[model samples]
Target: MSGERSRTDRTTLLARNDLVFIDFDGTISVTDTGIAVIDALELDEAWEIEHQWRRGEIDSMECLTRQWGMVDLARGAVYRMIDSFELDEGFNELAEAAIQIGAGLVVVSDGLDFYVDRMLGRLGWETCPGEEVIKRPRRCIPRFANHGRVTDHGVEISFPHRSPDCDQCGNCKTAHLQRLRAHFSRVIYIGDGHSDLCAARFADLVFAKDALAEDFAQSGRPFVNFETLAEVNEVLLAPRTR
Candidate 1:
């Protein structure tokens, strides 16, 4: 009886028209990969900029540009730091389940593609049919800067960035989500912490955590609160429909 139910559940999920949007840093992995980058570079002020970004005063790209200019780290060291990070325990299972359900998975994050791609590559989840690598230059680390400013919120610095048109973070999550909206049947976005908030409003169903989760609750944003990705995987296993 249990086996039959399992098969039915998989069939139902597979039959549904759905799309999965995930936030890379904290949601897919154990902690924030973006924060991990700053730590690896020995930059001690990432928290202040992070707070400002959460407050919506400055855009993520600007925050990242100023924040990363403080890092005195090497390119290899930075990559190694991100590579050492681990994925959320059940993330692989959740991803496989999402794929099995015919639900295309989209990674939308306020993090950089450099670390996002590195982390995703470690897990064997490669590119989709049309995946483009959007490059945003330094002011993001290994780009290096000389001058620094002490701000009311935090210390800020300026650096020459590769993709100036970009917001300055490693990745452009909002842009990706805009594109996702046009392509998917039903979109389910999952995230934790501050950065994920911007993209939350755009998803059909949002599963939130940490500070991001708190904002959803107080602001009356429709979202499901989850402690871990394991719980999220359970929800994904259940039947879903567009």
Candidate 2:
């Protein structure tokens, strides 16, 4: 999760004809998926790196660059571990409700796209990996089908954020939001960790919790408390002008 929109990005996004910004990991899923990834790798020490990043001691790129090196598992091993994650309740319902309102929802995360893809896959959301993750075409699966908000082809999958650190993330949420800013309106940012700070500033409304939640309040910015996707679903379904 991330936000701190430039005046230009914010204006363009808020004026957007039909767009909704979302954060993956904890916001979309029930729990912080990145933490789950670290747990899967048994990198309990990552909590330390995350703490430092939250303290502004380092950026996420540097944090991931240093922490990722500590892992010795292959991508397959990481996959198996994240697969065991328990999704947040009411996610599918939230997605469906947002789409039902004629809103285009996009999830941008500062985490690895591979794990994000797998999680979405289990939810029956089909996605075509953007060029950043796979250099070549992979098999296309059955229509991206989910109990709630399923896209016609698949959700827009884009990642591999550029940077001086450019570390592997569950998703490149910062870059994703930047791209969306070029053509979106009524953006909303949701997240609960250190990775979310930058992009959180860009959102029209921010729903925060945990570190991100605390960060906003301390900074004198207002945000809503969010405990579950169902809580978010309530907000999405609330009538609003586009």
Candidate 3:
């Protein structure tokens, strides 16, 4: 919960060989920011668009592009709505623990980077704008997500992180995981939705909940079940019995 820690201090303590990739919406935040935006702005058509994405009828890029096009609210109103949402109570604990344990923590989300950066900023985690993190290395909690710009007309969305070979997700969480995994000895993934399924499969350790947990359970894949970030922190920082 200590937001006063400097980025340099935290980065100095980070271990280069270990990393944790987390989902944003339902994992770190108590609610899904995208859905909240749609509902708050009364973008009724966006719901059907979401349903299409859920049914696998459209890729997330098209889905989000369509939904964002439907947005007619003022930029300030949209940002105000985003600021109203709350993060998981235990997220700060998990983040602090990750720094304490020298494990790198990054958020890889399929949602908008605008909101993601705002949310992380609320926790005092410094962030680099847009795809700048990819070009410049920083000691902050890096985020990968679809890019969004608020215009007088509405919100314009773009996919700067989507995989060249894949169209299913806007940000392509799997691609980010694959790239980061090479530099880390162990990679841990924490998520709760469909966007997480692909990346979670490639992780060295997975902590799953909600749809992600259901999918892994149905497939008989191994994963640790968790209900809160606190539980994740406990497991990660616990004394090894072995």
Candidate 4:
């Protein structure tokens, strides 16, 4: 949370028509929570299930469903594991900058909503107490990801945001991006995994790393490469020379 920028600086640099869409898990969080959950629960087969999704052998809904079915841990244990995860150091600063500049910031993920909700709650991005009482009320960031519920048997996954026609992704980031594009003049997408590929293709500007970066590099697609959210904040709030 370093290099804090002033509200005036952000307002001057950031575009009012820009809508920033960020991916959770590896992009914001230090580790991918879905993989973390599988590892924490000692579900060895889940890795293969994920690989199947990566290879296009299975859709994300089946991938998550099959993987979660292997989890035998209690609900409390799962939640504790999720709570142990950490977000990128600069995430809070970036989020604050977006708010200050009056830019729409939405977190779109292919991961489960359970961990997304827990991680965002750490930053007070879930829900504020009351906007009337607070001077600058925090905006509750919207999340689009698959739903997960821990039960006595195992974790049950449901896709409330899934595209009726597309089976490639459970949450369908591309569909969400298309829907948001109607409202915003420009869309800036930040992500680091295979799940972000479809959405990145449709974004006005893309900040990529990890697998998504590699994919864009191989395809010769235009994108800004970044290893940290600090870099993203720097680019977004950098003073215009022109």
lDDT of 4 by residue, 1-242 (tens): 12233434543255766788889989999888888887777778899999999999999889888887887878787777788887897888877776676667778887888778888888766732211111223457667778888786667889888787677999888888787777667888899998998889998778889999999889888777888988777777754321
Q: Note the clash tally of each candidate.
A: 7, 26, 1, 0
lDDT of 1 by residue, 155-186 (tens): 34443222344553435445456665665566
Q: lDDT of each structure?
A: 0.59, 0.57, 0.78, 0.77
Task: Identify the leading candidate in terms of lDDT.
Answer: 3
Candidate 2: which stretches are off by over 4 Å? 1-18, 74-76, 128-159, 163-179, 238-242
Lowest summed lDDT across 10 adjacent residues in model 2 is found at 141-150
TM-score of each: 0.71, 0.68, 0.86, 0.86
**Predicted candidate 2 versus true structure: per-residue lDDT over 140-208, tens digit per residue:** 221111111113322223324454333534344555656665554556776787677777777767878
Q: Which ten residues in a row are the worst by lDDT in model 1?
A: 136-145
Tell me, by TM-score, which candidate is best.
4
Candidate numbers, best lDDT first, in rank order: 3, 4, 1, 2
Off by over 4 Å in 1: 1-15, 40-42, 128-175, 239-242
RMSD of each: 9.0, 9.5, 7.1, 5.9
lDDT of 2: 0.57
